[model samples]
Target: MSHLVRSGAWVAGALVAGVSLAACAADSAPRPIDESSPAPDASEVDYRDGEYAATGWYGSLPSHQDVALTIEDDIVTEVTITTPAEDPTSLQHQQAFADALPGEIVGQQIDVIALDRLAGASGCSEGFMNALAEIKTRARA
Candidate 1:
């Protein structure tokens, strides 16, 4: 019985250590928002006049969201969000997006737009950022 107990303790310790290491590695990974990395620009659009989908996460949380972005002449004209948000009460994101989206994409390149600004969005902002990232990655592909 003592041997079994010791084995179980060792297993649990190993599992805990493994999880901690994984978490630390993820936290240390390079982020997409690093200022040193070149920003994605709209001019990189080789294909235009189509709708694309993007998916993103809120930091490292399990929460995720999706966005459908329309590109015209390398500019994001329309963004149709497929997933709403984690919370129902916060609808500020939709309104803020309605007000700022057009101006945000005007002269800027499609790839350049980062979720950095939207992180401030009230409820669904993080999800929106993740979705936007996914969309841009897809567009570039």
Candidate 2:
């Protein structure tokens, strides 16, 4: 009976040690980020051919802007901007700004450096630039 109790205690100790080691191993393993999470900032982006998107806000009113870019051979083939504003006037302004983006942005390399405001979309432009940086980070091959 004493021998049986001793053997049981030894087994329990071994089981606890095994579980502790497994927990330590799991804690040390690197966890992957979810796909929806924002990408980390990357310098000198080498874009893989795919569509990338990002969102940003600007100014006191804080209009939301979403920018999506389609890349082919490291060149921006298409650019789309969606700005949802609270006020009607703001919406119109944002829409016009979004409309002008393709003309200015298309045919350029994915590395957007100097985005200028056009057609009263200065605030949206700032948001667009911020989103562009995020897009570049995700574009790295």
Candidate 3:
């Protein structure tokens, strides 16, 4: 019993020390809005240059959104989004997300973009990201 207690103490101390080290190493600095590393050059693009569109559906009620984007030199030069949200609340959130997405994605690489809660709309972001995946697939094809 005494040996067991000693071993438990050792383990607890080890865990505390490990956690302290990790906390010390962690930076409070938030991650950049664009989480990706460097993008490929124009000539090195694996995807073709063109316009593509996709529909993203998300949430329990199955809300969806449509997105159209143009890529030049593997970078998103233009983007358009259409939200078919019927519920007034849903429409407001979706509209807010739609309004903010272009500023976030334009002039950025397609593959590098991953949407978050833009304009305080998480559900809309889910739909938007879902749509972006399809656009990436079509662009790569």
Off by over 4 Å in 3: 1-45
Pick the winner on TM-score between candidates 1 and 3: 3
Query: What TM-score does each of the candidates earn?
Result: 0.48, 0.64, 0.67
Query: Where in model 2 is the C-alpha error above 4 Å?
Result: 1-45
| Tens-digit per-residue lDDT, 11-79, candidate 2 | 211101110111123477688979896775433467888777676566665566666777787787777
lDDT for each residue of candidate 1 in 93-137, tens digit (9 for 90 to 100): 444543454455544557676654642553346555556555555
Best by lDDT: 3
Error of 2 at 118 (Å): 1.6
| Candidate 2, residue 85: how far the Cα is off, in Å | 0.9
- Model 3 TM-score relative to the real fold: 0.67
- CA lDDT of each prediction against the hidden true structure: 0.47, 0.63, 0.67
Q: For model 2, what is the error of residue 120's alpha carbon versus the real structure, in angstroms, after optimal superposition?
A: 2.1
What order do candidates take by lDDT, descending?
3, 2, 1
Candidate scoring better on lDDT of 1 and 2? 2
> Cα lDDT of model 2 overall?
0.63
Clashing pairs in 1: 40-111, 40-112, 42-109, 42-110, 54-135, 56-130, 56-131
- Candidate 3, residues 19-100, lDDT tens digits: the string is 0111137788897666475755544546678777676777878776666777777788877676667788888887788778
Report the C-alpha displacement of residue 45, candidate 3, in angstroms. Answer: 5.2
